[model samples]
Target: MTIGLDMMGGDFAPLEAVKGLQLYLSEPGAPANIFLLGDEAILRPLLATHMIPEDRIRVVHAPEVIGMHEHPTKALKEKQQSSIAVGFYLLSQGKIDAFISAGNTGAMLVGAHYSLKTIEGVMRPTISTIIPREDGRTGLLLDVGLNADCKPEHLNQFAVLGSLYARHILGIQQPRVGLINIGEEEGKGNILAQASYPLLKENNRIHFIGNVEGRDVLADKADVMVCEGFTGNIILKLAESFYEMTHRHSIRHEYLDRFNFEHYGGTPVLGINKPVIIGHGISRAPAFKNMLKLAAKMVKSDLFDQMQIAFRN
Candidate 1:
């Protein structure tokens, strides 16, 4: 499998991205070939410095770069030669099995939507974060920052998507799906939640548990938590702050350390035709390495094919 990396996307740009490639290469049994997308002049020297095997790495020169603050749709349209755009083009053309970037997230989303498009039955594509549970196990949360506003049908689909990801990517079997709400009781949330509960319950594709309250997010109450992007994004940001707060106070603990976004590398834009991972803007070398690892797993799992089958059935 070939995985594409946007060498110029993140805040650190080519340097950190090249460092990430070094880290990934150093790992034992690292799967998939890497296609680095960026300026050839910069990347070539970095690759030589890092000693990445030429056979395992391919460089695609894209001189243009979409800035972090640029509008997603506009940048993609105007900057056809940009790294992000080139990455998407390669992905759409099947030259790469997955595309990853720590740079402009909006551009990645816009590229995925317009270039590869969504799965046939998917109403809208969703992005999800890996939730580090209080226990040793991990969970999945969906619509983290995509589709802030959603319908009941959208939540139901998110449950399916999140569940498949949990099972295939996260190695959770029969992952339990939960609707995030204010209370655990059945009729407890707004119209969306109330409307979504039955769909989740009746859907045989996933193991749907009852409503999961805020307190349950860190616990094992649910393996896959589904919510609109607005609530999920708030929860995500709040969770991120916990790690920052702990660092500020110089408190070190195993559980708290799991909150580091770098550990997971990036969040994958689920429901797209191909795997597209969006890394944090401030992602460093370790984060990039993890993103590639995750991308490799997603491609190996045939995740999008599974989604198409699930949605079709």
Candidate 2:
């Protein structure tokens, strides 16, 4: 399998990406041939300096790059030669099994939507983050920032999507689904929560466990938390800050280390036809390596096929 890497996307471009490739190559059973997408003039020297094995990889020179602040739609349309655009082109044409990037997130999402097909029966493709639970197990949270406003049916579908992801990617079987809400009772919370409760409870596709309050997120009360992007993003950001704040104060602990985004690498734009992993803009070597690992796992697992079958049923 060939996995495309956006060598120009992250804050520390080609450099960190090269270093990450080194890390990935050193590991045993590292699957997928790396496809580097960026300026050939710059990438060639860097790859040589880093002593990257040429036979294990291929470089697709993309002369342009989409700036982080550029408008997603506009940058993609105007910068046809940009790394992100070319990466999408390769993916759409089946040249790459999956694509990984830490660049303009808006551009990545926009490209995925337009360039790839959505699974049949999926209302909207959602993005999810891995939630580190207090009990040492991990959970999944969906619609973190995509589809900020969603219908009750959207939340219901997210439950199914999140559950399937947890099972296939996170290695959780019969993953319990929960709706993020203000209360634990079935009829509690906002209009969206209240309306979504019955649907989740009724949905046979997932193992629904009723509502999970804000405090229940990290407690392992649920394996898949479903919510609209507005609330899910807030929870995601707040959790992210815990790691940042702890490091700022010189607090160290194994538990806090789990909050580091590098450990998980990045989140996949779930529900899409092909695997597209988006990394943190500030991602370094470790994060990039993990992203490659994730893309490989997703492909080897035939994740999208399982998702398509689930949705079709």
Candidate 3:
């Protein structure tokens, strides 16, 4: 399958993204097609510099680079040649099965939302994050950084998506889902969580685990955790710092390394009609490669099709 990789748009730019590509291409069975978007002039030389196989990679020249600070909606419309926009355009045109970028997240989200669009009946697309659990497995968290303010219906949809993701990628059967709230009590969180609780409980599709607090996440209390973007993003960022701290304190324990985002490659943008994976801003080649690998699996699993069925019912 064709997997589009955005060579630009990250904090480390083309260099790290190239490294990720190399890692993927070096695998025994690399993707059939690797469409790299960004300035071909800058990207081609880098491939040659690393002595990577040029024939395996396709370069699409995207001259305009969207700054991290630029507004997503404005940049997408004005900067037609920007890496994020180009990636989205190619995805929409069916030139690629999936798209991965380590660029400006807001711009990427905005571009992907408008260009590729979301599944019908999907309130909004959430960037789902998965963190390796202490038990040698992983759990799913949604709205990582996509939508801050959400309604009860939005949270309900996220639960469905998160559960399906866990079951497919993480190998969790009948994944137990929960709402990230202030307290474990049924009536704990604000109006949103309180309102969403009943909907999730009523829905027999998922294994509802009532309310799950932030601290209980690593305890394996829930397989799928749902929250608004504001809450989920904060939890994700804080976990990053904590994971780094644990690594520095004792490098001997190999388990601490499992918490890294590089292993998962990147977050998957849910609710989109087509699969679009968003990498970390500072992602490199290995990370990008992993992102594409994840995308390919999503396609093989028919994730979007499954989502259509899940939401349709």
Candidate 4:
């Protein structure tokens, strides 16, 4: 499978991306063919400096770039030759199996929605992040920042999507699904939570295990935490602060270290037609490397196919 990398997306473009390719190539096993999208003038010299093999990588010349502050839809339309736009074009044309970018998040989302489009039978596509549980295990949280306002049906789809992702990419067989709520007992939480609980309980697509309180997020109370983006994003940001706080005070702990976004790479737009990963705008080489690895795993697992089959039934 060929993976597309947006070489001009992040703050330290070309250099960090080239170093990331170097790190990925250093690992054992046959790596996927990579299509590097960026300005040929800048990327060629860096590739040469890094001594990247030409046979394993192909450079696609993309002269423009979408800035972080630019409007998402506008930038994509105006800058057709930009790296992000070029990457999506390649993905939609089947030139690449997956696309990875650490650039403007808005442009990436806009491109995925319009270019690849959402999978059939999906109400709305969602993004998910890996939650590092306290027991030295990992869990998945969905709708972290996408679709802040959602219906019960959206949460139901999120559960199924999150469960499928955990089972396939995370290797968690029969991952337990939980609705994030204020109370563990039935008939609690706001209107959205109350409405979603029944759908999750009744749906056989996921292994629903009732409500999970905020405290359960860090513990292993549930393997897949389902919530609307509003609440989920709050929890995600709060969790991220733990690492920042620790770093400020010079406190070092193994569990807190896992909170680093670099370790897990980037989060994928879970319900898209093709695998599209969005990394942090400030991502370094390690984060970029991990994002490529994650894309490879998702492609190998045929994650979109599994999701389609599950949603169809």
Top of the candidates by lDDT: 2
lDDT of each: 0.92, 0.92, 0.84, 0.91
lDDT of 2 by residue, 84-111 (tens): 9999999999999999999999999999
Write model 4 residue lDDT over 1-313, tens digit each, in one string: 8999999988887799889988987788845889999999999999999999999999999999999889999999999999999999999999999999999999999999999978788999999999988888899998999889999999999999999999999999999999999998889999999999999999999999999999899898899999999999999889988887888999987768878766788889988789999988888899888989999999999578899998775
Pairs that clash in candidate 2: none
Candidate 3 TM-score to native:
0.95
Q: TM-score for all predictions? A: 0.98, 0.98, 0.95, 0.97
Q: What is candidate 1's lDDT per residue for 21-48, written digit by digit as tens?
A: 8999889999989999999998898899
Model 3 residue 186 distance off true place after TM-score fit, in angstroms: 1.7
- Better model by TM-score: candidate 2 vs candidate 4: 2
Superposition error at 203 for model 3 (Å)? 0.6
Best by the TM-score measure: 2
Residue range with the least summed lDDT across 10 consecutive positions in model 4:
253-262
By TM-score: ranked, best first: 2, 1, 4, 3
TM-score of 2: 0.98
Q: Which of 1 and 2 is the better model by TM-score? A: 2
Tens-digit lDDT track for model 3 on 1-313?
Answer: 8888888778897888888777777889765578889998898889898777878878889988888888888888999998788888888999888888888888878877678767888888888899678887788998887789999989999999998888877778889998999898898889999999999999887899899987887767899999999999999999888777877887556877777766778898888888888888867666777887898888778677888888885
How do the candidates rank by lDDT, highest first? Answer: 2, 1, 4, 3
**What pairs collide in candidate 4?**
none
* Candidate 2 backbone overlaps, count: 0
Write down the RMSD of all candidates, one decimal each: 1.0, 0.9, 1.6, 1.1
- Residues forming the 10-long window of minimal summed lDDT in candidate 1: 254-263
Candidate 2 segments whose C-alpha is farther than 4 A from its true place: none
